[model samples]
Target chain A: MRIRCPLCGDRDSREFTCMGHETYMHRPAGEGWGPAWDSYLHLRDNPAGVTRDLWYHGAGCTAWLLVERDTTTHDILRVELASDAKRGNA
Target chain B: MVKLVEKTPAEGLLPLEINGISLTELVPAAITSLMPFDGQEAAASALLSSLLGMECPHPNRSTGRDGARAVWVGRGQIFVVGKAVDASVARHAALTDQSDAWAVFSLQGHGVEDVLARLTPLDLNRAVFKRGHAARSLLGHMSAVILRTGENTFEIMVFRSMARTAVHELETAMRAVAARDALR
Candidate 1:
């Protein structure tokens, strides 16, 4: 599998380290929130097929990547930098 | 700060020749100095880019705990490569050569991977190993970091004592491959 970086071009999948899903939770502003914490820590989907994941290019630029990958085959399908994805490049 | 030991051939390998450079240990401290820049990943990228004169195409970041970064120096300990500039030295976060350590062995030939696969579990497919991708894994029951220095060459780093074991395993594997190829 290969990952294409906006600045560095495409590189082998081994150069990237999988950091899991990109979904994150915002902290509650005030008051009791027991369930929120529990859900944040434990309730995460463990899908088997094409999944979106957070990967880091620890050998290149330290860019955070959101990649679509086939978990069963470890084949990466699409990759976008976190900075670009946040800018709505979807 | 850790003391640096320059390993000699006789102390580690049998009938050692002046062929490879080995460090006494993986001594994490040697590369720690390169971690203090504002964006450590950028700094690492720049260092390799400037040194190698090629764009380093891997994502890099400081490991954060001890100003370490997970560099692809091949297999094991997630090689933390760092450098220190004058300004950052005062922070007690800089890594001098004393802080980080490495042992470089130059292994070249047609079947280098065939020999390496015997000691490491990594999938060394050109499509997989490529260049600039390093992994932390075991080599012959010892911790090691393997770096692909060239298309047909690799620089394997391990603790000082494991150096002998590593060389033995590598030579044995290489000879085995040669023998097998001869039969074929």
Candidate 2:
């Protein structure tokens, strides 16, 4: 499957590495240690169907992307720059 | 202290010509990375225009005449090629000298796209990928920046450490393409 990078156009999937989920944007900050940190660091849910995940465009633009894809069908629903998604622009 | 002499990344390994294809190292005066701070895109672009004498390139597009150009490397980042960037460019953007960080080469000849097509996934057809178009993609297993500098000429940039690997890959592809042509 090809992933369309927001900045680099549609590129082969081999150029990207999937980094599990998009929860990387929700790091437990300032408050420090607690169960929240534990959950953020260790716990994860392997959900099927449409899911949001983080992908690094390592070979192409080197941009972090938030990819919304169907885990079952492997159809990419959307691809946005993680920075833009964090800024509510995606 | 001993005198230090500068050597190019592909020193003694390039200027190779096989059949009609040639691969040669390009030693530019400087290659600086230009990255605009958040919300400073317009400001940085305006400054870069006067300093580099060219418009700041858009994503996947390069701008400027020969000997001086800006090739977009990634989102919010551009590589200023063939010219020593002006100091004022830093006021609106972050400037980092990448002169020695990359191995730059010029690959030229007939069926040059055919040579690259075997290495990269990029569509190298001349009809769509014209002069000034650029792409950040893989050349074999190595990440590379490929730029179209002319109709039959292309500029390939990879990390300095991968100079030998890059040359080897391109040379193999060049010879294979040349051999294929010989069969026709």
Candidate 3:
């Protein structure tokens, strides 16, 4: 698989390491051992359709990317810098 | 106490020639990593441009003459080579000395592109990755920054610790390409 990095252009999947879902980026704050924290740490939805996930470009630009891909067809729908996604700019 | 001496990353491992391809270690005067602060991109670029006497580099591009150049590393990042960066630019960006952190080599020959093709996946056709274009990609199993300095020359940089591995990989590729070309 090839991922087109927003900063480095297209690169092979060997350069990237998948880091689970995009929600893994958001951590619950002001927590003192609660279900919200537990779910955030352990819960994951294995949807078969479209899903957004985070990938680290460890070998190339080292930029974190939020990739929207379809699990059924393995088609990449969209890719943006994770920082831009976090800032709600992408 | 005993005194310690300074040695470059690829001090004795390079300056190798296999067939027509030659790999020579390049010890630039200085190498500084520059990253502009938010909202200071233009200011930082202007300062660096004036200092290097070249336009500020854009993403995936480098600018300047030999002995003084800037190679874009990634988004908002560049490495100033060959000259000591001016302190005046510090107000616009963060500068970190990387002269000792990387091993740089100049690979030149008629079939330089064929040697790199065995390592990186990026398209390196002359028309596409023309001179002054830069890219951070994999060279064998090691991460590397590759720049096209001339039609038949390329500058490749890898982590200082991977100097041996980088040289070994390049040598292997050079010999393979040379042998293949001889057959043709």
**The best candidate in terms of DockQ:** 2
lDDT of 3 by residue, B81-128 (tens): 889898888899999999889999999999899999999998899999
Candidate 2 lDDT over residue span B74-169, tens digit each: 878899988988888788889999999999999998778999999999888999788999989999999899999999999999999999999999
In the order shown, the candidates' Cα RMSDs to the true structure are 8.4, 1.7, 1.6
Task: For residues B87-161, write the lDDT of model 1, one tens digit per residue.
Answer: 333242234342324444556666678878877765677676665545544577765556664576555666655
In candidate 2, what are the lDDT values of residues A17-90, reduced to their tens digit? 99878877888777769998888888888888999999999998899999999989999999999988888932
Better of 2 and 3 by TM-score: 3
Model-by-model DockQ, in order: 0.07, 0.80, 0.71
Q: After superposition, how far is residue B101 of candidate 2 from its true place, in Å?
A: 1.7
CAPRI category for model 1:
incorrect
Q: Taking the tens digit of each residue's C-alpha lDDT, what string does model 1 give over A1-90?
A: 777755445655656688667664133345667887666556778888888878886654467777888889988788887767877833
Candidate 2, TM-score of its B chain: 0.96
Q: C-alpha displacement of B30 in model 2, angstroms? A: 1.0
